[model samples]
Target: MLQIPSWKRILILAVCLFGIVSAAPNLFYGRVEAHNDAIAAAEKAGFETEAQAAARAAWPDWLPSGLVNLGLDLRGGAHLLAEVQLADVYKARMDALWPELRKALADERATVGAVRRAPSDPGVLRVQIGEPAAMTRALEIAASLATPVVSLTGIGQNDLAISAEGDQIVVTLSEAEKLATDNRTMQQSLEIIRRRVDEVGTREPTIQRQGSDRILIQVPGIGSAEELKALIGTTAQLGFHPVIARGSATGTVPGIGQVIYPSVEEKGLNYTLDAVPVVTGEELTDARPDFDQNGRPAVSFRFNPAGARKFGDYTAANIGQLFAIVLDAEVISAPVIQSHIPGGSGIITGNFTVESSTNLAVLLRAGALPAKMTFLEERTIGPELGQDSIDAGSVAALVGMAAVVFFMIASYGLFGVFATVALGINMALIFGVLSAIGGTLTLPGIAGIVLTIGMAVDANVLVFERIREELRTARGPARAIELGYQKAMSAIVDANITTFITATILFLAGSGPVRGFAVTLTVGIITSVFTAIYVTRLMLVFWFERRRPKTITV
Candidate 1:
């Protein structure tokens, strides 16, 4: 009477086999990882190198190759806590606003008198007018440039605060706009840092916002914190400005609406350039490392349609004048505009090595960080420490597993063997699910598996004890087994459901290693219930039907 339907039995066996096969790749993690990397590299490059081909051949192409990602603690790497300099964005915004404000005021010079920018706070733009009585007109002109803040909370608020102070008009961002800008700056910094890290092809890097202004970056498999810092800290802000004059760095002073920048190649030379760039890197569509006409390393860049139009007009109108290529506020090159360039494509030639050119191309493609970042904390975890943790975790798991298996066997003679087999299958299924989902394994995750090993046999213990009690009442073996399973079902489901809910809460409320533990616990609960209720029951039903035992002990 106690028998599994044919389809149900087949489904259970199929799932067990799938779990085993899917989890097999983790056993050969090193080889499979190399093979996967090789495949990825070949696809990205559109051709296979000899080493890549050899690595690919090492692993069979037909097998499932998904592996559980190791977390920072499990695979030593770089960790950095960086606070974004949000005020830097405020200054840049003010700087960009000065030109537009100057032009607007210039149109009303008869009413507002001669206008010039005055030194003020970092984020404040101050304008001085010759006619003190026309301060009201200056205020009106500044207010005209203010736009409504484009945020939900700041819906009715304007972005700028304009007030007349004596003969000067003070312009600064409104409080609501400052808040909005801070949010945007943090978001942009996080995205740029993530893009830069991903360009290096590292696995499972944690690039997450920690607090309001800080970002926590944990890049597993990276060489060091310094390496990651170098990759992301460059800013790579590129722009093209019209050069006013090039002279020795000794005593040249920039005029109003202009700035002086030192030449990158020529140490003693400086170039005075317009503060407002004709085109910025934000309009770049593509950048690639290439060789110049003389076979020297260079970076080739193409701009978008709007940028192309602006660049073409500027070059055509200023032929024979010097144009400065600026990166991070330094003049990389100052070349004379020989002819009209229409396509918005150009090469940046400087004292660059091939590696620098490639890095520059990567950075330009990723875009620039919105603001500077200051590293608050930095650490480099060693691989040796990670190996020790892995070894310790492995030993704990094996010991816990051995203890559970021994206890199950000692308490319930031959029935314990069925439970042990189910336990092994449950472990495989847990790993199989983790791999399928690309879950990360941390040190805490390993502890969760050890906890799962102990919990895996709990359902079997309940069923076996129930069966023993049924046998005392003179029920037949088949009838007692069926009743035992039926009676134990409620208790097993209640216990696992409560535990699963707890794990879910932990996952939702936690982060990093806490979430890792929750993931393994959650997966273990599902697989353990499946193995205990279905797989073990199916095994027992088969053995009992074949032998036709008249009497049995749980």
Candidate 2:
């Protein structure tokens, strides 16, 4: 009475076989991982060695090689929570706007009178006019500099909010613009951090934005949080500013639109420089570590065409003046321009060690962080602890699985054995899907698998109990089996669908380990449903056909 089409049966068998093959590589994770890494390294180096060749032979290339990626907690890593200083960007925007505002007001000297920058808080640009009656004209000129915010939520709103306070014009970023700027700054920082981490080649590192102003980073196999912090903490804000004056006193006050920076190679030496840079590192096309003419370590850089022209023009005019090379607000060198510099290439020579020079080159090539960040919390997980977790999780999985298999076999005899086989296939499918999707496996993910092993037979149990009920009313074994499956379908769907919904919510709303758990659970639900309904039934049908009994006991 119950029959499966030959095509459906073949399809189910093919899927099960595929799951087994796909998940087989995970059983030998270490060898497979080494082989993959060796291939990657050889390809990058553009050469092959005997060891690499041997590694390649360890596994056939034609077979599926993807393995589930281990999460930070399971792999041992450094974790950091950093808060981006969004206000610093706001202040920088205001400072950069100062020069343009002054130039604009100066152009309208007849109407705005003598305009000068006034002392104000960070992110606030205050301008005072010599004539109080000229305030209105100054505000108009400042308003002209504002542009419409580009974001949809900020439609019809200006980038800068300008106001007149007494005889001064106060300028600050508008609320809408601030939100957009903060989002951009966070995204930029996240990308730069990812590039910096990737340059070190430490496997899969998790770099993500947290709240409005925070970032979470986790790098597996990293020695410590301090090491990771050292890698990305440098803002690497490279700039060439015209030097105003040189001094040894730290207490010297810089004039408006000027900043004082200490020399990197010289103790007690400082230089005052213009706030605006002639050329920033944002225009850099390439940077590499190389030796200077003096044979000392230095970073060589090339700029884009636009930057090259600006550098060439500025150098040609100020041939004798000193220009300060600033990195992260500190002047590395203030070299006097000996001749016109064209082609946009230059060397930054400081008291740099070879390692420092290499790191500097890497940071320059990765681009600069949009703003500074302060670490709010830091953690480093040791490999020993991670191994312990893996060991415990493995033991728990084996124990839970053994208990489930034993319970199933004891409950329904041959039918339980059928359910147990399906459960095994269910797990294989879960792992196979995880590998295929490149999903991360965390500690909680392992727990989810263990739980799935116990829950996988629930559908089979429902079908078996329904068969017993159908036996009382149905005339034959085939008729009872058919009615059982038909009646059990609704309940199985309802239960699994509700559980799948919970997993979806966890994946969407949760982060880190919670998401990992959700992924494992969701995959488990899908595979369990297939194995219980199709795989277990296929085994039962085969057994029944072989015996050809008039009545069968489930």
Candidate 3:
């Protein structure tokens, strides 16, 4: 009557063994972490060092090596909330559209009369025509400039809204285009931030978009908020522009459609270059820190096929002319084209330290942020505070667990000891599942585990009480035990399923530490149910079979 299917018994034992093995690495956390880091470094370097080899050998590859990643709250790190300046991107888009719009209008100057730029709002591109009567034809030409938005959400909508007011034609981004641009900007910012953080090789950094315009960044093991901010704050816009003029005077100014930028190596030396770049960093396929022929620190870059073809054509036609290499609108180098440079490879040399060269390479490789971001909030959580939290949580868990164990033993004797053992296995399974899924453990997650320890015996308690009641009416001890399990099944399943639903809702709706708590609570519910119903029953059956007890004590 109390029999378990052979296959089911084997499955339960396999799960227990897997959990124990998987959770074992956490006991030697530092060593296992070192082992993982060494492997990653070795793979990146294409060779292994003596230290790396030793680290690898310390943790075998065949074993389950996954470990739970610690969250910012528990690990102590820098946090930042940055808001993207969406209006700045809009202004830039309008500024770039000016040259093209001017050329288009000039092509039909015979019909519309002379067209000139008219001052307007930051993101509004307005042009005035000499003849207001021909505005209808001009409006048609201006409307032609509005292209269909390529985004799914913006399909069938034009990128620009064109309107004519008296003699002035106004152009601004359409509502659909603005929505598309905002989404694209946020996604690009998130990706760039992630790349920058990953370049530094930080462990388990949390970089996510918070709202439409804000990004939330958290980096554990990083020193300060300033440091984290520095890694991501750079726009790192790199471009190649045809040089128009060069000057050393303090009051030098650029002509229309040109920009004057100060030299990076030589202060006060300025180079006037075209506002539009022949090629930008977005076309770069690769960038790395290297040394020039003169042994000067430099960053080498290679461009994609399209960029390479454009660059080759320009260089071929413009030999003996100067072109400016600009970074963040500052002239990094202005070198004359002596020969036709093919293949789209070049070096950026400056008065750079080894560190600066490396950082530049990293920036180029990560690509540029789409827009400027202003940090609205910054916080640094110290390791000492995190350690304090860990200590307090550890103490609370130990005390709670001891109280639960004492209560169980006093109430149910040997059956209570079996429940406690099952609870331990349940805890191991929770950690194993967390490691397997790469879940982050926060302070609230620790609380969830402690709460789970106290609650893990619920199913066992139900079965024990039912068995005691059944002992009076049942024919034999085995039948009583079987009936106990059968009677308790419905209540345990109903209770756990309800709680699991609540935890799922919390996980879906909550953020940060709340989500962390929900994760552990959900995992704990599943593991606790498994251990309470299955593991405890297996142990009890083994004990009863060995002793052949006429009457089992609850």
Candidate 4:
């Protein structure tokens, strides 16, 4: 074997030690980066002293934060599959059109027959009248019901259908509606998931809007799938409708889900024809949490010009009436209108806690998802479970490392110890690489590392084993070590390469956590080859150059 100088061996050892020692900090705070606020505060205060900076860098996250944490299966968290309802967009389209239908029929006094709501599918709602003699006028009027949509088409000769399920409709989403609903559902679901990830405060969350109606969200270190689901599932549709007339002892709005609002259940008139909406929530273009002029908590809104005009018209027509701001069909608040608001700007003042106000602002800013979502599947993993997993994985890793160390020592003696040293460096490099890559250390990844740890010893073992065989026949120690490496090179290369190929399969073919494991393992294998080949050879070369042993035993 070509001998390495003692000085060079010392240089490599120093480098390896430095890496191992430097990685020591990451071992504790790598996941959380320590007291972030304190670190930032010190930096801001210009506390640039080496001692201060080191304190900031070394301060461990004895208690990890939501940031830079591992998730379940690694840290242990639940996985969830969510489904968004594609029907609600169709419903909104239908509700918006009712006003237009009412006006057209009222303008001509054409509908002496009946005003009814019909649907061909849950997502498709169809409004039908007693076969109007003048279908053209009805169609024109219905076409103008809601903005953000075009006119309705028909399946039959004169009957009208919303061209898309998204269009203002005669419902049962005609063929067009289904396609539109699918697209909207996926888009909105992705947006909702993205918002939820931001809320959880993860560094980089993985969210995929899969298929036509499904969303896949992966938040590392966030195991609260339940909380996330609750936040996302709520449609939070906020609407402002003028309560034309209040029912005496009104129980609940029919077909609308029940929610408590300050109401008088004392029965008199069950319903009132005069109770019609003057304005709606659709006109709202922007909403934010703010303080009212009087210092009360309120939601301020800005409406589109069209909304301003419609709102102005409604207030002028019906002065001194109650306008209800409804959320998800439930009356959130109802206050009497004192005067007209022609600017399209308004504030909703209410008795709200700070948390409630902030939540409402978030919902509004996020644009209340197009429809309600359901949790088809949900899993919740607590922090305790995550910690336990970390502990168990740590123990397994240590045990595996100890085994490899013991094997190298028993088999190769002094030379085995050299291989162990190299193996140690390989493991440290694995961790540093993983940290730098910000890879998720899943359970499978831990397994991969353990497997890699064992295999890392293999290269050293192969070299030492080949040397022992060479020593059996060779005349001198120098010649034996040289032949050993030359003979072992082929075996080590072939073995590691094949193992890397297997890891590649696991990474590409596997799903979820399995892929995570494969990635880490593949990296470990590649790094191990470098350490064993270079580090072990350097030691052997150095030993021969200096000691110049007459006969080699180890």
Candidate that scores best on TM-score: 1
Write down the lDDT of every candidate, Cα atoms only: 0.93, 0.91, 0.90, 0.66
TM-score of 1: 0.97
Ranking by lDDT: 1, 2, 3, 4
Better of 3 and 4 by TM-score: 3
Please give the ranking of all candidate structures by TM-score, highest first, separated by commas.
1, 3, 2, 4
- Candidate 4 segments whose C-alpha is farther than 4 A from its true place: 1-22, 29-34, 37-68, 74-81, 93-121, 129-170, 174-180, 202-230, 252-289, 299-324, 333-348, 376-379, 465-494, 539-554
Question: What is the per-residue lDDT of model 2 for residues 1-554, given as tens digits with 9 covering 90 to 100?
Answer: 76889999899999999899989999999889878878887886589899998998898899889988888888898999999999999999998898899899999898878888999999999999887887877788899999999888899999999998898999999999999898889889999999999988777688889879999999987899999999999889999999999989989989999999999879999999999999999999999999999899999999999999999999999999999999998999899999999999999999999999999999999999988889999999998988888899999999999998898889889889999889989989998999888888899999999888877899999999999888887569988888898899999999999999999999999988899899999999999999999999999788877886798777
Compose the digit string of candidate 4's lDDT tens values, residues 341-395: 7898887667766667767766766666777677777777676777788789889
Q: List where candidate 1 sits over 4 angstroms from the true fold.
A: 251-253
Q: Number of clashes in model 3?
A: 0
Better of 2 and 4 by lDDT: 2
Better of 1 and 3 by TM-score: 1
Output the worst ten-in-a-row residue range by lDDT, candidate 4.
150-159
TM-score of each: 0.97, 0.89, 0.93, 0.70
- For model 4, what is the error of residue 163's alpha carbon versus the real structure, in angstroms, after optimal superposition? 11
